[model samples]
Each structure stands twice: as structure tokens, then as C-alpha cells.
Target: MNESIAIAWPTDDELRAVGETKVLFGHQSVGADILDGVARVYAGASVAAPVIADVSSGEDAPDGTLMHACLGVNGEPLSKFAAFAEMLDTPVAEGVDVALMKLCYVDITASTDVQAVFDAYTSMMADLEAAHPDVRFLYTTVPLTADRGWKSKVRALLGGDDRMGPADNVARERYNTMVREKYAASGRLVDIAAVESAGTDERSQDGHTYHVLNQSLTLDRGHLNEAGSEAVAAELLKTVATYSPVA
Candidate 1:
């Protein structure tokens, strides 16, 4: 993981000239804010392009995740859709150490077919890892179910329409469990979902028990409250600190 892999980043003006780059930035208080908070907590570590992929499909587009997206490297422009391969081809970049990035939460609950999601992610990860030996991608778990009304719970229990409920939580934990089983020791994952559910409650649905978000940690279903963001940010910092380059 060379600290000096300088990417050919573009200036703010250059980015403005292109239409594609405009859409990814300017989220007032969402994913990027949390990562920014994490960077602030770890004195020596920093987060760059704390943004989500502007591209719509996670499975097909390199821009589907922030790590895969072509981001404004240190507020300067690089190629619009430069993925990890592009980063590895050039000299070391300044904004982010291309060696590692947490693949931001992809909503597994959105897909009942968790195996397919994992298969796609695994396929993407394997290629990236194979091509860029210097790079390590960190996987993260989905946030706990924050939309747990009894009606929704019942709906989820039935396995029909509820996206966030007891069964959904079970899915979250199941996938997260697999992640830990596969990646924890190697430092390929940072379990932000664990922090999000710290001291959370457990409820049963159709003989399955799963975790729910502590109300303190959520603004609503699938959204983080201020405390929630802070907790996640700190945990992310802890993970970054472990593998961060020594100053």
C-alpha cells in the first residue's frame, strides 16, 4: 500500500465542465458526513470521496459503490469513472489510499435473494483483489432494522412486503455473520452494523429472532439519527486505525 500513488485528479472547474461528475457530490447530511466524522476522529487517518455511486446498478457499474466510483480525488477531478484498476495503473494518489475502502452499505434487505447479492459482491471483489494486490476492500454490514412497527413486523413475518422487520433483521445478521466468518480476521471487513445495534433489542418473528436498532441510533427506518451517525463514524475510525499507514 504505497502512500504516494498519485492519481491524475481534475480541478473543481474541470469537474464542473462534465455533467456526470455533478450528480455524485452535494449530499448535505448523508453517507459522506458520517465518513467525514470518522476521518475527524482518527487523528492520522482521513476519508476521501465520502460519497455513494452515482451509477444506479451496484452489480454492473464500477460506480455502484463509493470505492468503485470515480470520485474527485482530494477535491480535484480524476477520470469520471475510474475504478480501482485505473487507480492501480497510475502513480499513488493523494486523497485516498486506493489500497483500502469500505464498500458502503448495500441494502441486502432490498433483495430477498441475499445469496445473489453476495455472489455479485464476491465476484466484484475477487477481480479487484486480483488486479490490485496493493489494495484491500473492506466489507460492511447493513444497518439494523429501524422500521419495526408491529404491522411491518407482521408483514415481514409473512414474508410479503415489509422491507424492515424481524425477518429482515434475521437476513441482516445472517449476511453479517457470513461476513465475519469469512473476512474479520483478515481485516477485510468493518462491522458498522454491530455498532449500530449495540445494546439493541431482539424480537421474534415466526420462530426467528433478530436484532433491531436502538431508537437512539435511528432517525427512522433506514436512516441514522445524530447519535447513530456518531457511533458509526467512531467505529469506522477504529477500523481504519487498525490498518492505517504509520506516520
Candidate 2:
């Protein structure tokens, strides 16, 4: 939340000069307000949502600005990334300048080899950068969470998610560390993990990563509460303004 010390944010004049940059934010429930937050933090100079109907993520692509159709018209997430990608192939997103592919909860709790996962992620980013040479492809960090206790089991019943426990937290940290060190590690990436900590949770070795405080998360043990969401939103604006700008 401290913008002054943030390593790479753009000057207000530069951000304003860039005008309204269209950004496609591929995310889950926690990211719902990110665009709106960008509007609030940047005020008149904002990162606007892209034209979704024209994007093409996959073969079953919809015809129009269908990115908004991923969840139907009801605001639910339907195969989120797949749909987002599918729509990007369409014509509506031709002018999109930036894309944030939000990693899923499964990536954090799947209990997989962190290195292998990060390697695959790096490859994916490379591919994206190759495919969309003009658009800025930013790597995003997943938020840290406390042990969900019985809530983990509840998530399993609803769908499938690994329990948010010591081992899972370790994996999450490992992945995030790789993201920071291997990726730009600066303003080019959206450091969701670095910003959500409220100084109330346990810290990682670097001191920037912290588990989500109970106050910052809903009972699900992973999703961001209003305060957490707002904090993240502010950081996201800084990240975009600092790195992905109008050319």
C-alpha cells in the first residue's frame, strides 16, 4: 500500500499521458474489483477493461465480445482462463494493451513440485509473450492464506482444493519466490502476495510475503475480504501504471 517506496510506478504525468489503457484481467472472485480499484486509485487516468467479446482463448470460441460471456451474464466464473483466452482470439480485443492471467487456487494447493510448476509457468508466459508481442503479459502472484481448517474440507465438497496448511503454504511461498526472482521481480508483475499482508500475519523469509489475516479474508480461508481486496486493488494500479503503459 505504500506507493512511494514501490520500486517502479510511473510518474503521474506519464500515466496521464498514456491515457486509458485497456487491460484484460483473467482472475477469480477475489479479482472482481481490480479494474474498479484502478479507476479509483488513478482517478481520471485509468486502466480500462478490454473488449472481451472479440477475444479467442480456445476452439469453442464465441463470436462476439464474448469475454463477458465466460460466466454467462450472471457474473459467475465459468472455466475462467479457458474462456478468457478463447475470447482473446476474437476481434474485440485487438486493441488490448495488457493482460493479467491470474493463477488459480489449485496452483497453490495442488501439492505439486513447486519448481516444475514454476518452470511450466515460465514456459506459458514465454508462449504468451511470443503470441501477443504487442501486449504486456504480466505474471501475477497468488495470495497466501492461513489454514482453512474444516473449510478446506468444505471446498473439497464444493469442488476440489488442497487444504491450506503448513505444507501448502510452503509450496505457495516457493512458487511466489520463483515468480519474483525469475520474472521481472519489479513493477512489471502484479505482486498480489506482497500487498495483501496486514502486518498481522506470519511473514516469510523476505518479510514481504505474509499469510492473509482473518480480517482480510472471508471464512473460505483463501478469498480476500473487503479490506484485503482494496489493498490489493491499490497495489495493482501501481503495478500497471509502473510497467504496462501506453506506447
Candidate 3:
């Protein structure tokens, strides 16, 4: 049987270095906020004892064995983003053997442009493949949610209001649609939107949204509670089992 390795990289080159079966959890909030959700996503699935690993700052690296779900304990989003951006600007390196790219994030609604996001993602994958012919790429679509306040929080953090507008919601939906279409175009990619959407509905029915922090759902909601995270993790595990050969 072929061994499956998941390389959680912040950039395309670093991703390429690890070679295939790469799960790219793109730019979403990290820290304890999503730890449970991440775990659930990985644990709920049917993997053939697949290894879970992460590439974060020195402080955040997982202490367990390589095959035991490697978690980047101290990786900062800003740093990862900067590194990814830099690699996009430079040339890809050689001898990188990555297969799939899996991305896990909380907010992918109608407010973000789905096409543009996937285009950017696919373009990077294309570049890496151009440099190394043996590599294959797979990316997960941004999950769908009804949290309209997510945009506001992002905007406020950037010096704007704490309320999201209709346009923001529309953009997020568009982004989600784009992901669905793009992943459909490539047989290797995984469409996580279905599971995420279902999970979001479950959260709403429970009289809570996913972005509950400190026992209170924030106004600019874009986080997940323990229950919600568990749901996501279960869905993710299913996705992995379906796509990964090791499973």
C-alpha cells in the first residue's frame, strides 16, 4: 500500500517540498479557537492510520509522532501569509513531492469572490506542477455558513464597522460557488462546502452560530464552538477517506 503524507505548508514551495497528498488549510484564524474543530475534522474521517502534521511557528509544532496528526502549534497567519506571498513572487524549488492540498477555514460565505480565490489557488498549483511534473494538487472549497457578521469583524479589524453588508454576503456565496465549480473541474480536489453547510445549519438549529467565543457568539461571527468543530472534523475525515488512497 502507498503511504499518505499531509504537508501543512504556508506557501506553494514549502507545500511542493513535501510532495503530494497535501492538505492546505489556507488563511483562517488559528489558535485555540479552532483547535477542537481541526481535531474533529481530522478524527471523524476514515483514514488508514494516516499521519496528521502541521507547519507552523516553532512554538506550535505538534509533539506526537509524524503519523499522529502533526499540528503546527505556533504558526501565525500573518507569517504564513507573508511566506506564501513571497513564494508566489519567486520561483518554485525542485524535488518537492506533494499530492493533495487540503485547506480548512471557518468563513467562506457569499461575501468573498469564489472564482478569484480558486483561480489564485489553481494558478499556484499549476506553477508548482510546472516545476515538478510528478506532483498533483487537491484543495478544499471554503465552507458555507450563514454568519453575516464575519465580514464586519474583518472590516472592523481593518478599521471599519462591525456590521457586514449585503454585498459582503453575496461575495462570500460567490466565492463558495467558485470553489465548488473549480473542484468539480479537477477530480483530485475535495468539495467540503456540503459538509460545512450542513454543519452551519446544525449550529443554527442549536440556537448558536459557529463563531462562539468565550461562551458568547460574537456579533461579527466567524468562529466555531466545540459541537460545530466536531461536526466539521467528522465531515473532514469522511472527505479524506473518500479521496485519499491510504484510507
TM-scores vs. true structure, each candidate: 0.60, 0.66, 0.51
In TM-score terms, which candidate is top?
2
Model 2 lDDT tens row, 1-247: 1111222334564444334556566665555644444444455334433233322343232321113222222122234444555556666556666666666444565356667657766766677678888877667876666555576667767865455655566667778878988775445877777665444456453333435434443435567654555567666655555554543
- By lDDT, highest first, what's the ranking? 2, 1, 3
Poorest 10 consecutive residues by lDDT, candidate 3:
65-74
lDDT score, candidate 3: 0.38
As for candidate 1, its clashing pairs are 4-92, 5-91, 5-92, 5-93, 6-91, 6-92, 6-93, 7-93, 9-77, 10-77
lDDT of each: 0.47, 0.54, 0.38
TM-score of 3: 0.51
RMSD per prediction, one decimal?
Answer: 12.1, 6.9, 10.8
Give each model's clash number.
10, 21, 44
Candidate 2 worst ten-residue window by lDDT: 63-72
Q: Backbone clash tally for model 1?
A: 10
C-alpha lDDT of residue 191 in model 3: 52
Candidate 2 scores a C-alpha RMSD against the true structure in Å of 6.9
